[model samples]
Target: MKKIKYFYNTNTLRYEKLVTPLRVRLLRVFGFVSALLVSSALVIWVYTRFVPRPTDKVMEYRYNSMKENYATLKSEVKTLQDQIAQLEKRDNEVYRSIFEANPVPDSMRVKLIEKKKELDKVEALNDDQLSNEIANSLNNIAARISYQRTSYDGIEKLINNQEAKLSSIPAIQPLSNKDLTRIASGFGMRIHPIYGIPKMHNGLDFTAPQGTPIYATGDGTVTTAGVGNGTGNHVIINHGYGYETVYMHMVRIKVRDGQHVKRGEVIGWVGSTGASTGPHCHYEVHINGSPVDPVYFFYNDLNAEQYDRLLKLAATGSAKSFD
Candidate 1:
């Protein structure tokens, strides 16, 4: 180290110092480096304490927000599921009522059963299931709705088909409020009174006195009402829905061809003009061009018990002529 002397001039406010050059330069450099280090340390400490870190509070807040969103989505899914169940129940009731009113086709019933099974599967799901489960339930509901729409389409098609077929066939009672005892012969294989051999009897014979009133069986147009030597004053009515009825052995025909007639409307008077044994009305029901027993036509007029009884009787009765 070098010895240094220093002097001060107080009047001029000036200071003077004498030292070795190398030692003074080293001390100055050391002081400058020390001050830089102190400043850097202070900056680092302030940043560490005052500013937010990269992966701490921000990440926690984001996690909580995600959880809240998931909860809200789950609740919405549950509400939608409940609504679907209610709609399915209502649809089932409507389908049941339709079945009670009219016979359900086999194909429609099968689809309904399939929908019910899908609904059952949806109902079995738990709330804790993932989003995929909710999506699956939504898909099933859409499929069921599609199936119901298809079922309605099928029913409409069936109705249209039936109506077309019924336009050609005859199935209705020929008269209303007339004495049922006037039926002298019935349908089935019977011995022809004239031929004395087995013959197919297509209609019932109502033996009424000449000039007894005859009525239409259902709403229809009279297709034909004229003389047929064998049937004797025949009238063919075309009722919609695969139904047609024939009225024969009439004394006077009141309805013309293509004339619309309602059920229970007088269309003629009973008489024996054809190959008749007496003055009677021969009524027949042809369903889709095939003859069914005329007794079945009266089914609509019977109550449930009476209809059942009639069915029982028909099931057990011996084959008899409905000539």
Candidate 2:
């Protein structure tokens, strides 16, 4: 260690100790602290950026599951589509050709082909992609809506009463993939979440955020669009041909009674208004005014496993939060 040197004062003839200046001491301290902070910041950045986060792992797992499910759905859709095409071919060869009636235009078939191309291009859809895919599909549907009401109104003149060109019934989902949500509860008998008693749940409960848009599964006229018993702010559509769809627990209703709505048209939003559980949509399908399983009819784009899971979830979901 070096000792501090002292200076001798000739006037007083005394030894005086040499001291460092205040500014220099302060600068040294500031520099050390600045280096330490920089090193710590680098270490944190490396750890957070390089290491896997929990959310990432979970998302990866979900994405993998969705990919598998989507693959299965794609196959099923292809098979169903092949069956439909075969049926249409049979209709044209055996039925339409006999009367020399032209089958539906290739424009509609071309749209279907475009949709299939879009579906094939999607390997796995993330949340945003899934939302967009659904939105685009619905928008496409809305943009190219035919064979719904216009076909039914003047059916005698359209295609000589051909059933192949008409898809008037509710064959698709009221809530498509974009608005698809986790099952809150399902149809059939279950213990009431609130009342705590054995009861029959007439619809599939979809857990969604407030203000999530709800759509009409098929082309229909709004038969009922107001608050009802137990269900809050509900909308019921009459698809004719003895088919009806009921959407309950709406935050807001976009249509009024007697108003016509096409498939994929927005009608309402998810809400916790009526029976009072949480934000969700309670959906029901009816045939001749009798409630039927809504889950069976949502075959718009779900894979088999996803559809099966929906059925399973409805069957095995907890008996809670139905209103």
Which candidate achieves the best lDDT against the true structure?
Answer: 2
lDDT, candidate 1, 134-195, per-residue tens: 55666676677667667766766776666655433333445542233344556667677666
Badly placed stretches (over 4 Å) of model 1 are 1-93, 98-140, 152-173, 176-180, 189-198, 240-242, 302-323
lDDT of each: 0.71, 0.76
Per-residue lDDT tens digits for candidate 2, residues 132-224, read: 575575545444333332443464354543342234466666554533456767788867767888888888878778988888888888999
Best by TM-score: 1
Query: With candidate 1 superimposed using the best TM-score fit, by how many Å does residue 40's alpha carbon deviate from the native?
Result: 9.9
lDDT of 2: 0.76
Per-residue error (Å), model 1, residue 5: 13
Off by over 4 Å in 2: 1-166, 178-181
Models, CA RMSD each: 9.6, 33.6
